[model samples]
Target: MMGFGLSIEPQLWALLFAMVRIGAAFVAAPVFSAVSVPLPVRIALSGAIGVLVVNTAHIVAPPEIFSINTFLAVAAEALIGLALGFVLQIAFSAPMIASEVIGMGMGLGFANAVDPNSGHATPALGQFLSLLLTLLFLAVDGHLVLVDLVVRSYEVMPPGAWIAPQRLLNIAMFGGYAFLAGLLLALPVGFLLLCLNVVVGMLSRAAPALNLFAIGIPASLAMGIVAILLALPAMGDYMLVIIREALAAAPALVLG
Candidate 1:
């Protein structure tokens, strides 16, 4: 076999080894790395990027591709990629979490629909939040930034390099921030709904025949929409935080 008219040798093996990292990350990441994306498409994307990585970085192949040591190094690359993708996965969970909080409050928690993007049946509120967040994320060119982050990973953690244990610790640690960010995003809506619930309960007590169940649902729905609109600015800020944290954690995940 030959590449670019040159005979395939040990040097070509470097590209193959490096590709495992890119492929694993792309396959596991959120947004562009979702399972909803066709496997063939994901593979094609990784291959295209791998080609560019090889030419741009001039990565050198191992002495023996099939040897035990070389295989272990390749495995290392795969682990790094998985870690990187997982970090992004955690970031994307923010919307789902916020939606859960909001949905439960709005009495919409049981209303679920299959999400085309993630291929899961999520609450309607969760699906809406996810879709809106995705649109906003794209509007900010987050995809390009993500690609840049992936490219930089090669520089910070070269192919076949062993990841440090602290990096794993860092990945676990970042999960704490996920909860914080999710709660912050959902707080305003949650609080508003909580107030609405209290008012509805008080009204039901004053007039038993008013049928609280019938009145509360529409009230909650309208209140939820108004609350969401009011909270939009804060939600955007929370999303930015999610993105920043994900990018910051990417290196640790990839190199750990």
Candidate 2:
């Protein structure tokens, strides 16, 4: 007669640590971290991917888990995961920022709705642009690319790898690009609205008793919508580039 029992191995510990990183990443990532997605589903996905990573990659387990060094290693892993996800978050936010600018310029700032992702009241234009970006993100399989980057990170950076301060600074600098991209996206519509405002001001000065508010508001709104529609194709193109750059940068940040 023989009895069999299960024992936890070093590889199992490595898998668990890997799952911690993956789960942290999903928690900070855009689509996967959406409020609509159940927490359990996110955990399952992290665990599944962690299993795949452990099976495919040669992950080195820390000699001890209940020690100061292991704690620091775990912290490092979580930071790497969070950095990877945060880069994508910054890229995704560019559309929302552009929408906000355009919405304000169009005199539609008052038309606010609850944002599905943030659960906060945002201008309707911002919501619309965010939705478009989200759809485009899916269409291009950006999520798959993100997952691939995270998976590849293990091989490139490995567990317990220390990220340098210069790399962190670079990540912060990368976020600045989002603001520039957003400004560029809104520039066409914003410029048109500015021109409309100037023209409206001139007309109001020429006719002292005329109601310019009624005319200016509608004109700006109409022109803004048209500008956005016309610029959409270009916006898509720019967003695709941003997404690609963000994905490409993840490995560098992690490996650093």
Residue-level error in angstroms, candidate 1, position 28: 1.8
Worst 10 residues of 2 by lDDT: 1-10
Best by TM-score: 2
Candidate 1 lDDT (Cα, 0 to 1): 0.79
- Runs in model 1 lying further than 4 Å from the true structure: 1-6, 208-210, 252-256
How do the predictions measure up, each by TM-score?
A: 0.89, 0.92
* Model 2: residue 203 alpha-carbon error in angstroms: 0.9
- Highest lDDT, which number? 2
Which residue pairs clash in candidate 2? none
lDDT (CA) per prediction: 0.79, 0.84
